[model samples]
Target: MDNITNEEKQQSIEAFQSVIRKSENALASMKSGSAQSRLLEKRLKAARIGEGLLAARWEGKELDVSHDELVEAKQVLEGLLLMLPGFLEKTKPGSGQRTYIERRIKAFQMAVSYLNE
Candidate 1:
């Protein structure tokens, strides 16, 4: 894994914080056990994972997965990226849910990039 500058790490942490807050607010309004709620929960989990990964990388302890595992993860995230637009379309424009989806897309893209590197 490439070493990230401190400036980049700080910016990423801040971005993750914003995404987490939005996701939490959106999830609070969603009915528990519903499909939408479940999906948002997954996205929230991803965001937390991404944040932890960033921190680990910054500490010079990047993930020790095999190259094959990284490639597989990147492929999975790519597939999700292709499907997210349909999910985004189901939400109202300018709504908190839509914003959360957008943030999720961004988080997934960031993960893909990290895996690619």
Candidate 2:
């Protein structure tokens, strides 16, 4: 982070925003009880994992946990980083995407805050 150029950081931030918006829209537009609902559910889970990864990057100091907890967090973060690209490309975006994604992000923050305690 210290060595990252300003331009690079800005680019990363913009990419992060794009990923978030695309993933959220896709996750939210998915219809419940559809044949592919289960798959959509999985994609939502992966996006939440990505949200956690980004949050940890920007808020690492506030996220104190045990070594085992840290390990679990790292695994989730890595999984999100790996899965996000394919998931984003595969899922079609819709109007309702942001609502569900935002709800999940709030829930995720609550869950992780408990781990910190």
Candidate 3:
């Protein structure tokens, strides 16, 4: 398999950061604001942190991951999805931002599902 270049890794990190920012912004916009927003925000923060750790691992700065870290990251992504309904309902369905968030949610769900298998 071909190894990912530094530029590719950086781009992946930036994309993940953009998803985190969008999620945060969406949560902040919800008027019905529930505890779920807080939960999702916390999970998204953890996911971003996990992405950083993964980047370090990719860079050979980390030794290895234990079973627990992998599990925690999976759980964080799941938590983010669990909070999505509230935010999704608030978004106008056809708006570009809403569409982007929906796509991100779908992508995140697919990743979590793949990790679980």
Candidate 4:
């Protein structure tokens, strides 16, 4: 339990991409080119910053970040969450998607805690 396994890293990447895809679909139904939609795109990019550390695993290559790296990456993601607008937090894309993001944030927090231990 000292570090996250490669499988865990891959799972995290998959989960991240899953949400991104869901967000994309959700965004698409809105105006083709709207402010909130654009902001969601930008937020997705910011959220995916940690995926770089796990890209090799996601791609089936020979690489993955260490426990400390995972912790740092999680911190980056948490920071990104903090920077999101209050409207996005309350009711822009609606409840389900927002809850998903909130759950993902919690999941990341738990993963970081586990990796740290």
Q: How many residue pairs clash in each candidate?
A: 0, 1, 0, 0
Q: How well is each residue in 20-104 modelled by candidate 1, as lDDT tens digits?
A: 7889999999999999998778667666666656666667686655666556556655777899899999999999878767766
TM-score, one value per model? 0.57, 0.39, 0.52, 0.47
Q: Write the per-residue lDDT of candidate 3 for residues 1-117, one digit (tens) a residue.
A: 125566655555565677778778888786545787876676666556555654665665752556676677778877777887778888997997676567556556544654565
Q: Which candidate ranks first by TM-score, i.e. highest? A: 1
Per-residue lDDT, model 1, residue 28, is: 94
In model 1, the runs with Cα more than 4 Å from the true position are 1-3, 61-110
| TM match of model 4 to true structure | 0.47
Q: Give residue 48's error in model 1 in angstroms.
A: 0.4
Per-residue lDDT tens digits for candidate 4, residues 4-44, read 66666656666677766777787778786689887676555
Can you tell me which runs of candidate 4 are displaced by over 4 Å? 56-76, 79-103, 106-117
* Cα distance off (Å), candidate 2, residue 32: 4.1
lDDT of each: 0.71, 0.48, 0.64, 0.56
Comparing 1 and 4 on TM-score, the stronger one = 1
Model 3 stretches astray by more than 4 angstroms = 1-15, 20-64
Error of model 3, residue 27, in angstroms: 15
Model 1 residue 20 distance off true place after TM-score fit, in angstroms: 0.9
Candidate number with the higher TM-score (1 or 3): 1
